[model samples]
Target: MNRPTVVRTRDELRNVLAPARRAGRTIGLVPTMGALHDGHLSLLRAARQRCDVVVMSLFVNPMQFGPQEDFASYPRDEERDVALAGQVGVDVVYAPDAAHVYPPDFATFVEVGGGLTDVLCGDPGRRGPSHFRGVTTVVAKLFNAVEPDVAFFGQKDAQQAIVIQRMVRDLEFNIEIVVLPTVREPDGLAMSSRNAYLSPDDRVRARALNQALTKVLEVAKAGETSTERALAEARAVLAEAGIEPEYLEARDAENLTPVTRFGPRPVLVAVAARVGRARLIDNVVVDATPANEPMAASVDTTGGAPCVGRC
Candidate 1:
């Protein structure tokens, strides 16, 4: 197996990717917090298919984790991550240290203001805007360092993907943001690095997140457009599995605003729950229209089908 050349600093990344830039070859970036899984590799495969040079960043960004969050316990295995990237034909693995990513007196941050940072995972009582601030900042730094033509993200992080897309547009990053489908285990649980923390029982309970989202899709397809009504069905699914979600909400997928009813624009039904030591999240984008009107986007009703994956 061919191993990707791993670089540990911004200068090394720039020096490495400069040739591709000079040669006018398109470079695609897959920014990750290491702990490569099928969900992450799916993005890598897409990048390999679309770009001449595929750069995957393996930095486990400290800034994104809240004080009580599992930054310390979050998984990291550079050797295995590099092997996985190599398997997908990833050209470069930029795995920088925390000090390098956030140097001393590092005061700058990138934030997407307005309501996008005010709801769901961004709620002030939860991870809040600080989480996304950390995310956008690191992403901006990566954009500057790699200067790739495109960036890949998974739809499982529905809000993060949306927020990053906004940041890209507002900041004029000159990179294409491609949101791919969420990958899941055969049991319907969305694949996440945090899944590593799940105990066996927690692993089974974690399936509720996807099951809940699937319930929302079912209700919407049945002409139940009321966000409250659909979410009620979703909550029941969580309740059945004895999994109380931190937040289960339906919002306008495009702007992340509260949606009273699913309309022409897609509605994002998302859930975040704590299962044992793992904080798992899952979402399905609902494109249900009234029975009288045609559906807005093609959707898959299969139990574990991802929201954006089918849409």
Candidate 2:
């Protein structure tokens, strides 16, 4: 078994992929922050299907975390991450440190605007702009370093995926951003590295995030056109379950404009809430009429968050 080559510096990564680039071969990049899960594996699978080679970047970004957020304690197991990447047929593993990525004079950052940095969970102080700023900065660096033909991001972080696509378009990176459906646990909880913080009991309550989102979809599918009604009911569901609902938004999946009352537009119902030690988020794009199937396609394909082990 030939293990995936481990790269520790930007120069090394670029050199590793140079041959493929020169040969006009396609490459897919799956950027992740360690703590491998089925969700990350799903991204790997998506990249494998579309490209000639796969490069999985594993680095926990401290810039994305807030003052008191779980940056230092974020889950990390590079050994395990690399092992799993090899299993999924990853060709190379690029793992860079802060010094290598953001040297002593690294004062510049890539920020995105157009109201994307301040909507839904990415709002002002509640881990929105700054969080996304860090995400985009790291992603831009990765895109430049490897210069892959395409990149993959999971739908579990629906807003993140949208924001990244916007950045790529605005900044004009010549790479395609492909989003796969959100991978979920058997119990409906979205698979996340943050899930490691959930205790056994917290794990059970975490399902409420999915439950609340699902109820909104059910109501929407049942001919509920009132955006406020779907959001309120889902909020109530979370409140009743002792979960603190942060934001519930119904927006056009394309431009991400806020939707007042549902209509013919593609609407993505997204929510974020604090469940125990974890902050969970989930969304589903509902078609206009009740007879229509759910819109899983966000910026590319179509359908709602797909269940794992079944799709």
Best by lDDT: 1
Q: Candidate 2 on 1-311: residue-level lDDT in tens? A: 35899999988988998898889999999998888888888888778778999999988887887886877887778888899989988999999988898888888898988887788867875876888888889899989998999998877777788888999999999999887877778777777777878889888888888888888777876778898998899888888778887787889876788988776877888888777777777777777754555543422222123111100
Q: Give RMSD (Å) of candidate 1 vs. truth.
A: 3.7
Count clashing residue pairs in model 1: 0
Per-model TM-score versus the true fold: 0.93, 0.92
For model 1, residues 102-189, the per-residue Cα lDDT tens digits are: 8799999898987998789989988878888888898899999899999998888888888889999999889998887777787888
Instruction: Report residue 227 deviation for candidate 2 (angstroms).
Output: 1.0
Candidate RMSDs in Å, in order, are: 3.7, 3.9
**Whole-model lDDT values for every prediction:** 0.82, 0.79
Worst 10 residues of 2 by lDDT: 302-311
Model 2 off-target regions past 4 Å? 289-292, 295-311
